[model samples]
Every structure is written in structure tokens, then in C-alpha cells.
Target: MTVPTLTLNDGKTIPQLGFGVFKVDPEETERIVTDALEVGYRHIDTAAVYGNEEGVGRAIAKSGIARDELFVTTKLWNDRHGADESKRALGESLEKLGLDHVDLYLIHWPTPENNNSVETWEAFPSYRDQGLTTSIGVSNFDHRYLPQILDTGIIPAVDQIECHPQFQQIETRPLLTEHDIKVEAWGPLGQGKVDYADTVIGEIASAHGKSWAQTIIRWHLQRGHVVFPKSNNRDRMAQNFDVFDFELTTAEVAAIDGLENGGRVSGDPAEVN
Candidate 1:
């Protein structure tokens, strides 16, 4: 199946559905990513901190897919917030990925305690200008950080956040919309903390003849957020990619949206530093 793309603020396009290797074992990354590639996933999201970029690179090399057909993304880890450290970090990540440039590179987290998020963001453009990464963005950033980052005369193309049916990020969505920054939902399936089988999601999934995971993925797509759900299992990887065949109705989307109850299942951006 062909995946839809989203145009970033910089005019570059990203595949809306991709594969993520957040906690995948380094030893298993190559085989798992190869399976995902075989299942028709061209966009792969990994980070230096994941300790699996080399495996991802190996899979890409072995797959024999052309470079242009893939969208690869990696991130700058929290400890590398200094200007020089950030550049060096990307260099190391590129070396590991076996690519000269990544399609997108992100600040993994705000690391608010360091008081250097803006400084880290400031160095991002140079990475793009020097062709180290085509686009730059921030992840797990609170809306409060945007104004400061905006003052640097650059707007992020997207913000990768921990979003699912339970924690909708209402407080940050308006600011992101005002700035034309797209949302990339990291835990689109709620990171297993959400029990889809017995909730409204289950009912919605039943009505559509789709699994709860698939239904939520459909909800994310219809909401226009870029989503990449991860799985070590090949069948589940194909299932996640199969969302393009059906579209969710407005009411169905609303019912899923109504599941929000401030249930954030990951690190708090404010405290991650």
C-alpha cells in the first residue's frame, strides 16, 4: 500500500506513516527493520540514543532500496545540547546510519534543566544548510518552549510528541497550529498503557472490522498527525501499514478523541531534563 505524505513548513514532504524503533533491541533491529522494509515501510525513525542506527543502516543496505525512496530520521540526544556536541552527535549518527544526510533530525527532548534548549535549536539550521539533515524539528517540547525557539528566527517543521487517544495534548495543539508546525504522534497506540479491548476504542474497532491499534492509527491519520507505530513482529508491522484502505468517519474520530483523560504514558517534557 502507498502511504500518504505530509508537507512540512520547509516545503519538504514526509511519509505520514512510518516505522519507529524506539525500544527495539539492537541485536534484532536489522532483521526487524528488514521485515518492515519488506512490508512496504519506507520511512524509518531511529535515534542515536536507541543504539540501533547501525542495524537500521545494515537493513537499508541489504534491502537494495534506492536512497530517495526512503525517509530516514534520527535525533540529537539530551546530553549533546552544546553547539559543538550537537554537530558531533549528528556526525556520529550519520556515520552509524551510513548516510551523508538524514531526511529529518530532531532534538530528542527539551532538557529544560540545562537551559540550553534554545542554543541546541539554534544550531539545527546549520545542519540543514550543510546537508547533514534536510529538515530540523523538536520532540517532547512543551508549547512554552516555542516562543523562545521562534525568537531564533527559525520555526520547527514538526514536533514529535507522545500522543494517543488518552492524552490529546490540547494545551499545545493550538500553538502548534498557529505556527503551522505539524504533529508527529510517537505513542499513537498509547504505548500499551491503554487497554483498547474494553474501551470505546474496542467498540469503534468492532464497528469497522479493524483492530484497536489499526483504528487508532486511522484516527491519527485522519487527524493529520504523522504517525509511526513500532513492532518487532512482522505481521503487526504489516497490520499497521494496512490503515490506508479505510477512512474513519467524523463521528468515529470524535468518539476516539473523547477517550482523552490526561493519560500521558511517557516522560514529561517539563521534567525530562
Candidate 2:
């Protein structure tokens, strides 16, 4: 099945469904990413901080897939928040990934205390100008950081955030909507906080003759948010990518969305430095 694509404000397109290597072991990233690629995933989300850029690179190299056919995303670690450091970090990430350019690059965090994000963001256009990355964006930037970045008049094409059925973003998403920022959900499966095993979600999955995971992924797609659900298991990796064949109804989406009860399993963007 073919995954749909979302066109970013920057005139670039990203696969609406991809694979993530967030906490995957460095030694295993190559094999895991290779598995994802074999499962028809054209997008791969990795980060310098994940310490798996080389493995992700290796997988792409071994796959022999043309660079233009794949979308590779990486980020600048929070500690590397200065203008110069931001440039240097992307250079290093490109080196490790064994690619001359990445499809997308993002500021990993706002690092609200040091307050160097604006300068770091300012340095990104040069990377695009120089062809180091096609698009630039941010991650874990809440309302506080969003306005600051917007005030600089350099809007990000995408915002990688922790979003799932249990912690659906209602308030913060509107800010992205207002600015036309595409939502790329980081922890799209909720990290076990809300699994497909739930009665409501499982019932929906059974009704559709799909797995609960597929049901949830379909919900993310229908909501117009980009999703990258990660998995090391080969079966689960293929299962997550098999979401294109199904569709979730409006009532089912609402029932699953109603599970949101302030269930944020990840760090709060406002508090995490």
C-alpha cells in the first residue's frame, strides 16, 4: 500500500507515515532501519542525540535506494544550541549519516534556559541555501518557544511533537494550525500509556478487521497529522506500515480521542531544558 504525502509550506513533501529510531540501540539501528525500509517505509526519523545516525546511514546505503526516493530526518541536540554549533552539528550529522544532505532537519528542543534557539534557527536557512537539508523545523517547542520562533518571522515547516491518542494535543495544535505548520508526531503510539489493547480501541480495530495499532495509525492519518511509529520487531514494523488499507470512522476517532486525560508520558516541553 502507498502512504500518502503531506506537502509542507516549504514546497517539500513528506510521507504521512514513516518509521522512527528514537531509542533504538546504535548497534541495531542499521538492521531495524533496514527492516523499516523493506516494509515500504520511505521516511526515516533519526537524531544526532540518538547516537544512531551512522546505523541509519548504513541501512540507507545497503538498501541501494536512491536518495531522492527516501526521506531522512535528523535533529540538532539540545546542548548544541548556538548559531555556530547548530551549523557544525548538522555537518557532523551529515557526516555520520553518510549523506551530503538530509531531507529534514529540526531543532531538538528549545532549551528554554540558555535561550539560544532564535540564533540557532536563524542559522538553518544557510543549510537550506547550501543544500545540506531540504527543510527546517523544530521539536518539543510548546507555546512559549513557538511565539519566539514565530516572532523571528522564520516559520518552521514541521513541528515534531509527542502526540498520541491518550495525550491528544488540542490546545497547542491550534498554534501550528494558525501558522500552517505540519504536525509530525514523535511518539505516535503513546509509549504504552495507551495501547491498542484498550476495550474501546480494540473494539474499533475488530470492527475494521485490523490490529489496534493499525487502527490508531489510521486515526493519526485521518486527523492529518504525520505519524512515525517505531518498532524493532519485524512483524510490528510491517504492521505499523500497513495502515493505508483501512479507515477509521468519525465516531471511532472520537471515542479513541476521548481517552485523552492529560496523559502525557514524555517530558513537558516547557519544563525540559
Candidate 3:
């Protein structure tokens, strides 16, 4: 099936639905990534800190898919939160991914302790200018740093935040919308922390004749945000990729939205930074 795509602020496009490798075993990355690729997923999300870029690279190389046809994304870790370290981190990530350039790169965190996100994000342009990364963005950045990063007049192409129905970015999404930055949901399924099976999400999934995971993924897609649902299971990976065939209704989307209770499964931007 053909996955839908979203146009970034920079005029570059990304698949709205992609596969992720958050906690996958490094030894199993190649096998799992290859599974995802064979399931017709062209977009793969990884990070240097994930310790699986090399395995992702190996799967791509082994797949024989042309470079331009795939969308690969990696990030700069929090410790690499500086101008110089940002540049070096991307270079190392590229080397590990076995690619001369990545489709997208992001600042992993705002690094609130040092408040150095602005300084680190400032170096993204050099990578774009150097042709090391086609597009650049940030992750886990809340309203606090959005303006600071944009004050430099360098708006990111996207901002990948931890957005799930339970913890929707009621505040951050609008700021990104105003700035033309795409919203990419990192844990679209709540890293399995979300109990969709016995909740309203489960009812929606039943109506659509789909799994809870597929229904939630459809929610993100219909909302016009980008999402990456990670799964090492081949069937589950295909299930996540098969969301394009149906669309959620307005009330269904709103019901899912109502499930929000200010819950967040991962590090909060306010506390983590």
C-alpha cells in the first residue's frame, strides 16, 4: 500500500506514517528493519543514541532500494547540545547510517539544564548548506524554546514531540502550526503504555474493523500530523502501515481527543529540559 505524505515547511515531503526503532535490539535491527522495508514502509526513524543506525544502514544496503526513494531520520543526543557537537553528531550519524546525507535530522531534546537548544539548533543550517541533511527540526521542544529557535529566523521543518491521544500537545501544536513546522508524533501509540483496547479507542477500532493500534495511527494521520509506530513483529508492522485505506470520522477523532487527561508517558519537556 502507498503511505500518505506530508509537506514540510522547507517544501520537502515526508511519509505521514513511518516505522521506528526506539528500543529495538541492535542485533535485531537489521532483521526488523528489513521486515519493515519488505512490508512497504519507506520511511525509517532512528537515532544515534539508539545504537542501531549501523543495523538500519545494513538493512537499507541489503534491500537494494534506491537512496532517493527512502526517507531516513536520525537525531543529535542531549549531550551533543552545542553548535560544534551538533555538527559532529550529524557527521557521525551519517557515517553510521552509511549514507552521505540523511533526509531529516533533529535535536533530540531541548536540554533544559543548560538551556542550549537555541545555540544547538542554530547549527542546523550549516548542515543543510553542507548538504549533510536535507531537512532539520527539533524534538521535545515546548512553547518555551519555539520562539527562541525561531528568533534566529530559522524555523525548523518539523518538531517531533511525544504526542499520543492521552497526552496530546494542546499547547505546542498551535505554535508549530503558526510557524509552519510539521508535527511529528514520536510515540503515536504511547509506546504501548496507552490502554486503547478497553477504552474509547477500542470502540473506534471495533467500528472500523481494525486493531486499536491501527485506529490510533489513523487518528494521527487524519489529524494531519506525522507518526511512527514501532513494532518488530512483521504482522504488527504491516498493520501500522495499513492505515491509509480508511479515515476516521469527525466525532471519532474528537472522542479520541477527549481521552486526553494531561497524561504523558515519556519525559516532559518542562522537566526533561
Candidate 4:
């Protein structure tokens, strides 16, 4: 169960497969996160807006896992995209997570309507300089906004985006690749919006003797994207992590790629503000 790591632009490495706590209940976050840790997940992704950083921190402390052995990620919320606001935001998130520094910090969304993402992105380097975060990136950002961020001479290490078979983000992938920025796929299973059970993916799963969810996760891994599929049930969490044994053939990956329909199940990056 050794998870592979991707090298970031800043020379840091991140676990390719991790656990994400997006909508998990705050009260149960500790228990859930604890279960994930026990199931062999070393990378944990949380956000200030998730309101569960305290619980995640509790689980980390209780596990007694050496801080250096784990990778933690949190995001600055949209409202904090003002001068020096992200600085305060990351400090608070660190406080909640009971950590002096996080492995990675991100701008949660572009929020273009606010017209301040560039200003927000400009300050990210300073956070890294201050040792508040080791790597800085953005989420839910598309080409429209990324160019401006790039113009600031700070290329993001990764762009956490909603990516699945149905919405492969064809328009944005090239841009990210061109910049050598890793694509961290959130909602890798389409957030339950696309039924993998009845599609070619299910057939592929049957052939590989794996679950539909596992098959999709394999697809993501095979495609070289960093992914954190969320699951509260320990068994399912383990199942998701059990993808390393099998490999999807090139044709099989092409079959999954065919499932792309150019649709997004979540917020439009340009409109999420």
C-alpha cells in the first residue's frame, strides 16, 4: 500500500492518492479522519471552509504519526482574497489544524467577480517565504484566470479541480500541462452524479475484479493526476486505496476517456464567486 508521490514545482513531493474531507460533518471529522488514517492514508486535504480542521487536527494528534510523515493541505476561502487577508486565513487554519506549517496551501476558488484573485495569488509566495506553507496552489481555477496568476510570475504547483470521466476538463488540461502544474482531481468519481455502475467503467471493473469506484481511481492514477477520493466508511476507504495492484491498459484508459462528455457537476470556476 505504498502511495506514489508527485514532485511539485517547488521540489516538494505529495502523495498521489490521499483522502479529502469536503462535506464531512465537523462533529464526526475526527472519527472519520482517524478511520482514514488507520486505513493507511497519509495525505489529508481539508479547508478552512470545511469547518472540520479541528477534528482533523485531533485525529492527527491522536494517531501520533510523525508530522513529517504526513502531508496536510488547507485552503484560503474566497472572502479572504484581499490584501494580507490570506495571511490571516492560513494562520487561522494552521491554528485549527494545530500545526505550525502545512505541507500545502491553496486559493480555494478564483472568484473572478471579486476581481482580486491576482492580488490574492501575489501574496502566496510570501506565505511560503514565511514558512507558513511549503507549497502554494489554486483550486477551481481555469485558463481564464490562471494566465493572470501566471503573469504574477508564480506558477502554481497544482490546480485542484473537479475532474471525472464525464467532465475531463479537456479545455484546461493542456494549459496545466503546458505550465507543468499537476492536476489534483477532486470529485474524481463525478461526485455521484455519473453512474459508473452501468457504464463501460463497470465492465472494466468486472474484468479487473475491482469495484467501479476503484476502477475510476485507477484511471485517475494511470493518467498521472493527484486524486483524493473521499469515503467515511473504513472499508470503502481501504477499497479506494487498493488500486495499486492492478494497471489499466492504454486502450482501457482510452475507453474511460471516451466517457468524457464535457460537463461539470460542480461550480463553474469563473462563476463560483
TM-score of each: 0.98, 0.97, 0.98, 0.99
Write down the lDDT of every candidate, Cα atoms only: 0.92, 0.90, 0.90, 0.93
Per-residue lDDT for 1-273 in model 4, tens only?
Answer: 789999988899999999999999999999999999999999999999999999999999999999999999999999998758889988899999999999999999999889998888889988999999999999988877788888888999999999999888888888899889999999998887788889999999999999999999999999999999999889999999999999999999999999998888889887788
The deviation in Å at residue 137 for candidate 3 is: 0.3
What's the TM for model 2?
0.97
Q: Which stretches of candidate 4 lie over 4 Å from their true place?
A: none
> How do the residues 1-273 of candidate 3 rate in per-residue lDDT, one tens digit apiece?
778788888999998888999999999999999999999999999998899999999999999999988999999988888899888889899999999999999998887888888888888899999999999999888787677888989999999998889888887778888988988998999999867789999989989999999999999988888898999899999888888778898999999999888888888777774
Q: Residue 255 lDDT in model 4?
A: 98
Instruction: Report how far residue 266 has shifted in candidate 3, in Å.
Output: 0.9
RMSD of each: 0.8, 1.1, 1.0, 0.7
Error of 1 at 208 (Å): 1.2
Measured with C-alpha atoms, the lDDT of residue 212 in candidate 2 is: 83
After superposition, the stretches of candidate 1 with alpha carbons farther than 4 Å from their true spots are none
lDDT of 1 at 219: 94
Error of 4 at 273 (Å): 1.1
lDDT of 1 by residue, 47-116 (tens): 9999999999999999999999999999999999988999999999999999999999999998889999
Q: What are the runs in model 3 whose C-alpha is more than 4 Å off?
A: none
Write down the TM-score for model 1: 0.98
Worst 10 residues of 4 by lDDT: 142-151
Residue pairs clashing in model 2 are: none
Considering summed lDDT, which 10 consecutive residues are worst modelled in model 3?
A: 264-273
